[model samples]
Target: MAQSSRRSSISGPSQHNALVSQNQVVLYNASSKGLTVNYIHPACHTVEEPDASTCPYCHRPLDEYNHSAPQAPTSDHRAPNYFHLLAIHNESTSRPLTPPHLEDEARPPLSSETMAEGYFDAFFREESKLGMGANGSVFLCQHVLDGNLLGRFAVKKIAVGSSHKYLVRILKEVRLLETLRHPNIITYHHSWLEPCRFSTFGPSVPTLFILMQWAEGGSLDDFIAQRRGISHGDTYQNSASPESEEAHMTKAQRIAAFKARTGAGASGTSRPANLKAVHLLSTDEIVSLLWDITSGLAFLHNRSILHLDLKPGNVLLTWDPNVLIPRGMLSDFGAARDMLHQGSRTGVTGTLEYTSPEIIMPDPMTGALRQTDSKSDIWSLGIILHKLIFFHTPWRNGNDDFSLLEQEVIAYPGFIPDPSITSACSRRGLPTELLTLLQSLLDRAPGRRPSCEKILLAIEEHK
Candidate 1:
């Protein structure tokens, strides 16, 4: 008797239905290698880039289909070659390659059981208060399980109920940081939600706890102050003209100031304040730091992420005291968000001093502040670099109030480094290359700012 054949069918949504469908069939040939047969719907044409829908012709969805069909038995046929049959089988039913572990799935959601574990209690215990901000309080916490006393971390505990928007912001920050892994960016260890009640608030609210690497030296603001020294002599010479003072500083003085301020004192060639500081930063170190930051920005931008709050405080030192160069990491993603598909209307979400002009200025026609974009981050970075080189913000002395400050930012978009500082550095004048980079980044129009990659390349080529 002739051998019988087995057939299988797959089912999926019809094209007429709101959801479309597709299907594929595999046939096992008794005398030869297997084959794949696709039965696509006529109406549902497969475009190069197809949206989520079923095949219009067959009314079957792509995912729903019978993957296998038995071969017909043939009495007179010789058996198929084993190797060819295996190859054909493999080709017909190959599975999609799995993505990298990091991209596998949304981080497993934090469970209430996990939250109730000692993780929260231990993190909050003996939390030496570090600082406080609009969002929450920062504390220096010890790692409970590791028993690494010196391995301190910063814990940011944000109380819920302020606003759902703020809660969403915190969640977004956690999500972004959890996936990012870079030396120049702060690391996110873990997070948990704790239920608590407050007397003033009346009802209890969920408090979110975020753990991060602790910056021992505190903010760059404090670091700069320490480098300049507390005495009047260490202060920028107010009496001398900016140009004249820069000219008078010796190489030793410049180097000492740079070392003292940046904490780049590894060479051990200590000289008195008379000589200019030998900017220990080789052309490479400066380039490296710039590259590091831009790379970080590029990563964020590629993922449609925006670090709305970009400032010196958000850029932290990585605690490398041995190296004779300024090494830092970026932190504080509390205000970051996805900008790929949506306009960011979150009003004025960054530091006042470093915010872009577009954010500060309201559109006259719409009577609303223009939304912030990746260019807003570039503008903020430009201001940050300006402060590093000049030791002051462009809008610092010009205004006493927010309104006046916004006016100043609009009027003078470029920051001219103090000539005094430039003149004082004997090894070289103010980093003109960095200044130019900053100017371009600070452009009022978002469209004009260079992409992060371009900025990184410019910094690398800076003389």
Candidate 2:
């Protein structure tokens, strides 16, 4: 690649801008800074690097998947691990996500030839809204077979524009979700794409519909609140107490308790509180929850998958329809990606508070984003564990999550749990092995972190 003899290196907003493509990647000059913008990163200075440079972010080569590695698994899992599902989901009334978890007709025919009505509309009927978020809304829908209500499921609807970038995200999520069959992970049943036009007409916007198992028990955040005791308004608490008092509480009782405690009649279902619930969990409850999540992560990382967002919100709880016991199941595949896939490693890809230090900081030598791998997931899990034990993450010592994360990212290569928090877990009978494992998971050096399988096996021994 060669550049013209005439070049400008303006520092601020200038009038000139030009697109530059090099080594199969496109770069552009900013009008103000005369900086090179990366193909994915816009308005950045010298963000595009040599195509041959390995990504400090994902730890993969700049080039996309180029090797004859194992082919990524498809939606149809050839070798299903029913035994894992049998352990938890089957114990109660759980069936395969089809048995594990639709259709609408008589609608004005879609004009877009590419609309996926043939697959999605033919089988599923969207009902009431179950949940909504910044990116999408989830609906409780019925799977219809020959006009019969086959079962109930949660369908996530994400609005998208017509673009390969958006399509890749949907495909990546579905493909990744499809391969995961562990009971601890939410079951992905089906997916479809449709045009975004019904009444309002404009450019043909696309949409994605992902059908997944409904976690009737809600998010782990709610579970933590229920197990811990939440209240409305200003609050103060450090640990989950009332373990003995809450021992006999069923999901209904706990939800009721949370409502009563949080003055839900005055407001609504409990919102996230900085304070912990009054009741702390017993050693057994804590162990079971930890084991469940650890097993789920093990299953994921074993397949070279990275759950970039492993926050409490994504860890859902679902009761066995038959047994009535609560089980922690991982959900939300939006930020997940295959490490072995074809592509350069990703940039920092998670909530800042839960993001690993390595991902936040840049490499001193390369002056680029530091390489982050599956070990980053381990760091996130360690933070989740801390939140479970201490009832909150010390992302920052001063004001808020952002500040806490800022403090840590700025102080990369150095982070340790507050000794008091670890001490509390110890008081609650967190075994020495498990505690060490936790520390290792959060090790500042990514290489020092244990594998998901090792964490699983070690914790199993403690259990």
On residues 88-185, what C-alpha lDDT tens digit does candidate 2 reach at each position? Answer: 22223221122111122233332354355344555568788876776688888875533544456788877755454555556667767776677789
How much lDDT does each candidate structure score?
0.55, 0.58
User: Which model scores highest in lDDT?
Assistant: 2
Per-residue error for 118 in candidate 2, Å, reads 7.3
State every prediction's TM-score relative to the real structure: 0.58, 0.61
lDDT of 2 at 425: 64
